[model samples]
Target chain A: MLEAIILTVITAATPLLLAATGELVVEKSGVLNLGVEGMMVMGAVAGFAVTVSTGSPLLGIVGGAVAGVLTSLIFAFVTLTLVANQVASGLALTLFGLGLSGLMGESFVGQPGIKLQSLDIPGLTTLPFVGKILFGQDILVYLSFAAVFGVAWFLNRTRAGLILRAVGDNHASAHALGYSVIGVRYVAVMFGGAMAGLGGAYLSVAYTPLWVENMTAGRGWIALALVVFASWMPWRAAIGAYLFGAVTVLQFHAQALGIGFPSQFLAMLPYLATVIVLVAISGNRRATLFNTPSSLGKSFVPDR
Target chain B: MMRLELVKRAEKSRLMSVLSPVFAVALTVVFAGIVFAAQGHNPLSGIWYFFLEPVTSLWGVEQLITKATPLIIIALGLSVCYLSNNWNIGAEGQLTIGAIVGSIPPILFPDFVNPLVLPLMLLMAMAGGALFALIPAKLKTSFGTNEILTSLMLVYCSNLFLDWMVRGPWRSPQGYNFPITIDFHEWAVLNAVDVGGIYLNLSAPIALVLVVILAVVMRSTLKGFEIRVLGQSPRAGSFAGFSNRRMTAFAFALSGALAGLAGMMVVMSEIGKLQPVISPGYGFTAIIVAFLGRLNPVGILIAGLVIASSYLGGEAIQTSLQMSSKLATVIQGVLLFFVLAADTLILYKVRLVTGREGEGARA
Candidate 1:
C-alpha cells in the first residue's frame, strides 16, 4: 500500500514538475507565457490522436511536443513580433487551445488510449521497494527529473544561460550588449510550450490513459502557481510539485476511506492549498522582489 | 528572404483605434471559414449559420439578448478591474457564489412570495460577490499576493463548493435525487416583459441602463480618472496621492458586486432555481467581451451581443451541421487573438522588408 501510494504521488507530480520546470526557464528569460494550459491541452489531444492512429505512445509524445510548439509559435508571433499584451495573448492562447483541442479530439473521446509502458530491467524487477519506486516509473517520470536538473544546470552553469538571465533581468541593457533578447525569449517560450505539451501528453498517455475535454482541469494554472511558490527556483519547484501531488493523492485516499467530509470539499484542498501557499511565499515583499525577474510580464519592442 | 517588422508611430493612430475591432471581427470570420473548410463543411453555410443566421429571426435575436445580458453586466464590472490594472480572473467563482447566495431567499424561504424577496436576493448576491472578490483583494493589499493566481484558485474552490451544496446540504427534498433546488416562487423571479409583440427579459433593459450609467461614470467621474491614472502609471498615481491598496480593493469590490448582480440575474431570470451548474463559462467569456469592447462600457454592450450571438450560433451549428458546439469556443478564442494582434496596429505600422535591408537598418 505504501509503495502504491508513493507511485501514484510520483505519477501525479511528474506532469506538474515537467510543466513548472519549463515555465521556470521561460520566466528566467523574462517572459511569462500563460498559455501553458492551452499548449498542454492541445498536446493532450494531439498526442492522443497520434497515438490512436499509429498505436505508438512514443509517436504520441512527439506529436504532443510538436503540437505544443506549433501553438506556442502563435503566442510567440503575437507577443514577440506584434508586441501585443502578454497576459491577454496568453489568455487568448488558452481559450483557443481549449476550444480547438475539444473540436479536434471530439472523435477521440471515449476511445481506448494507448498507455505508455513502464520501464523494466531484469535485475531491477526483482529488487526491493526503492528499485521499483525509483526505476519503475514510465519514461516521462525519469525525464521529468532529468529536465529539472538539466534546466538548473543550463540556467546556472552555461554562458548562454547567463545571457538569457541578462535579457530577462534587463532587456534594454542586454540589447545594448548586442544579445538577441527576442531570439533568446523565443527559444525560452517554445521550450516552455514543449514541456507543457509533454505534461499534458503524460496525462492522456500515462496517468489516465484517456482524452477528456479540459482534462488538464486547472493543472496548468497549478503549475504556474508552483513556479511562484518555488520562488522561481528549479529544485524548489520540484519540491512544490511533489507536495501538491501528495495532497492530490491523499485526497483520493481520504475519499476511499470515507472520511466524513464530502468528496467535493476534499477535492478543494489542492486549490485552497495553492491560495495559502501563494500568500505565504509572496507575503515577504523583499523576498519576492529579490527573486522575480526584473522584466517579467512586460512587453518589449526592439527599436531599430 | 523577407521579414515582417513593426515601426513605432510617432503618434497613436486615431483611425486604427476605431477600426481595430472591426478588423479583428473580419479576421475571425476568415479564420472561421478556414476552420469550417478543414472540418469538411462548406465554409459559407457554416459562417452564415454561425454568425448571421442567429440574428435574422426574432427568436434567435431574443436568445442573443438573453445571453448578452449577463455577459454585458459581467464585462462592465470587469472593465473596472482591467482598467485599474488589477487582474481579477476569477469572476466565474464570484458568479457562482453570487448565485448561491442569491438563491437563499428562494430556496430557504420557499413560502416568501413577497416582491421584497427578489430585491433582497439581489442585494445579498451582490454583497456575497463583493465579499468573495475581496478575498483576493485583501490578500493582494495586505500580503502582496498575486491576485491573478489567488483569484483563479478561488474559482475552483467556489465551483466545488457549489457542487457540494446542491448534492449534500441544499439538495432539493422534492427534486427526485436531482442536484437542484425547488422551483422559485413567481415573486422571486425576474419575469420577461412583453414589449410590442416581442418578449424581453427584464435583465436586458437593466443591462442597458448599466451601460449608460457606467459610460458616464467612466467618462466623467473622479474615480474613473483615478483608475485610469493608476493603471497607466502607478508612480504618477502615487504622486497624485491615489493609494494603490485602496484602488485595488475598490476596483475588486465594485467588479465583484456587478458580477454578483449578473449571477443573480442569471439564476433569477433564466434558471429560476439553483442547480449544480448555472453558468456556461460566462465569467471567462466576459473577459473576451471586455477586450473586444475595447474596455469601454458602450463597446462592451455591443461586444456582448456579438459574443451572445456566437453562443446561440454554436448551438445552431451543433444541431444543423452535426458539428460540436465547441466551434464557438474556437471562434471566440480566435476573435480574442485577432483583437490583441490588431490592437498593436493602433500604435505601430507593420513593414515588410527584405532580410538584407532589415539587417542593414538594424545595424
Candidate 2:
C-alpha cells in the first residue's frame, strides 16, 4: 500500500513539474502566459489522437508539442506584436483551446490510449523496495527530475539566461542595450508553449492512458500556482509539484483507507491548500517581492 | 492613391461605434467558416446552424432568453470591475456561492410561499457573492495581493464546497442515492407568464430593465464617473480624492451581487432545483460577453442575446449534425478573437509602408 502511494505521488507530480518548470522559464523572461491551460488541452487532444491513430508514443509526443506551440502562437501574436493585454489574451487563448479541443477530440472519447512503458534496469529492478518505487517508473517521470536541474542551470549559469532575465526585468533597458526584446519574448513564449504540450502528452500517454475531455481538470491552473508556490525557482518548483502531487494523491489514498469525509471536500483540499499557500506567500513583503516576477503580466509596447 | 486623413476634434465617433461591431461580426463569421471548412464541414451549413437556427423557432427563442439572462446579469457586474481596471476572474466562484446560498432558503423552507422568501434569497445570494468578492478585495487593499489569483483560486474551493454539500449533508433522502439535492417547490421558482400562449420568464424583463438602469447609472451617476476616471487614469482619480480602496470594494461587491442575482435566477427559473452542475460555465462565459459588448450595458443586452442564440444553435447542431456541442464554444471563442482584433483596427489605424521601410528605422 505504501509502495502504491509513493508511486502515485511521483506519477502525479510529473505533469505539474513539467508544466510549472516551463512556466518558470517564461515568467523569468517577464512574459506571463495565461494560455497554459489551453496549450495543455491542445496537447492532450493532439497527443491522444496521434497515439490512437499511429500506435506510436513518439508521434504522440511530437503531436502534443506541435499542438501546444500552435496554440501558444495565437497568444504570441496578440501579446507580442499587437501588444494586447497579456492577461486578457491568455484568458481568450484558454477559452479558444478548451472549445477547440473539446470539438476536435469529441470522437476520441473512451478509446484506449497509448501506454508509456516503464524502465527496466536489471540491477535496479533486483533491488528490494526501491526498485519498483523509483527505477520502474516511465521515462517521462525521470525526465521531469532532470528537467528541474536543467532549468536551474539554464537560468542561473547561462549567458542566454542572463539576456532573457534582462529582457524581463526591463524591456526598455534591454532594447537600449541592442537586444530585440520582442524577439526574445516570442521565443520564450513558444518554448513555454512547447513544454506545456509535453506535459499534456504525459497525461494522455502515461498517466491515465485514455481520452477524456477537460481531463487536465484544472491541473494547469495548479501548475500556475505551483510556480508561485515555488518562488520562481526551478528546484523549488519540483518540491512544490511533489507537495501538490502528494496532496492530490492523498485524497484517493484517504478514500482508499476509508477516511471519512465528503468526497467533494476531499476534492477541494488541494485548492484550499493553494489558497493557504498564496496567502502565506503573499502576506509577507519580502516573500511577495522574491516570488513574483517583477513584470509578470504587464504588457510592453515600445513608444513609436 | 493615398487616402486623405480627416481631422475631427470629437470625444466619440458615432459611425465608428456603430460600424465596429458589424464589421467584427462579419469578420468572425468569415473566420469561423474557414475553421469549419478546415474540419471538412460545409461553411454555409455551419453558419445556418450557428446563426439562423436559434432565432427561427419558438423553443429556440426561449432557450436563447434562458441563456442570455445569466450572461447579461454576470456581464453587467463585470463591466464595473473591468472599468475600474480590476480583474475579478473568480466570478465563477461568486456565482457558485450565490447559487448555493440562494438554494438554502428554498431547500430549508420547501413549502414557504411568502414573497419575502424569494426576495431574501436574492438578497442572500447577492450578499454571499459580495462576501466572496470581499475576500479578494480586502486582500488587495490591505496587502496588495493579486485579486486575479485569489479570486480565481477561491472558485475551485467554492465549487468543491458546493459539491460536498449536495453530495453529503444536503443530499435528498429519497433521491435514490444520487449525488443531488431535493427538488425545489413551485413557490421557489421564478414566476413566468403566457401572453397569447407564449410563455416567458420574468427574468427577461428584469434583465432588460437592469440593463437600462445600469446604463443610466453609468452615464449619469457620480460613482460611474469615478469608475471611468479611475480606469482611464488612477493618478487623476486619486488626485480627485476618490478613495481607491473604497472603489475597489465597491466594484467587486457590485460585480458579485449581480453574479449572485444571476445565480439565483438560474436556479429559480431554469433548473428549479439544486444540481451537481448548477451552472454551465455562465460566469466565465459572461466575461467574454462583457468584453464583446464593449462594456456598455445596452450593448451587453444585445451581445447576451446573440451569444445565447449561439448556444441554442450549438445544441441544435450537436443533435442534428452529430457534431460536438463544443462546436458552439469554438465559434464563440473565435468570435471574441476576431471581434477584439477588429476593434483594434477600427480604433487604431494599421500602417503599411510601400517603400523604404528601413529608412524609418533608426534604432
Q: Judged by lDDT, which candidate is best?
A: 1
Candidate 2 Cα misplacement greater than 4 A, ranges? A1-4, A120-135, B1-18, B352-360
Q: Which digits, one per residue and each the tens of the lDDT, describe model 1 over residues B1-363?
A: 886788899999999999999999999999989988988999999999999998888888888988999999999999999999999989999999988998898888888789899889989999999999999999999999999889989999999999999988888889999998889999888898787656787788889999999998889998889999999999999999999999999989888888899999999888888887899999999999999999999999999999999999899998889888988999999999999999999999999999899889987
Cα lDDT computed for each candidate against the true fold: 0.91, 0.82
Please give the DockQ score of every candidate, comma-separated: 0.89, 0.42
Model 2 steric clash total: 0
What lDDT does candidate 1 reach at residue B142? 93
Judging by DockQ against the true structure, name the best candidate.
1
TM-score of every prediction relative to native? 0.99, 0.93
Candidate 2: TM-score?
Answer: 0.93
How would you encode candidate 2's per-residue C-alpha lDDT over B1-363 as one tens digit per residue?
Answer: 221122222345567677777787887788768866876889899878778877787777777888999999999999999999888988988999988898888788777767787778888999999999999899888877667777888888888888888888888998898878898776677877875545788778889899998999999999889999998899999999998899999999999988988988888888787777889889888988988898899889989988888788788777766667787888788777755655544444545443344335433
lDDT of 2 by residue, A57-149 (tens): 879978988999899888887777656668777878888888999888988998888797887776897588889877888777777878899
lDDT of 1: 0.91
Best by TM-score: 1
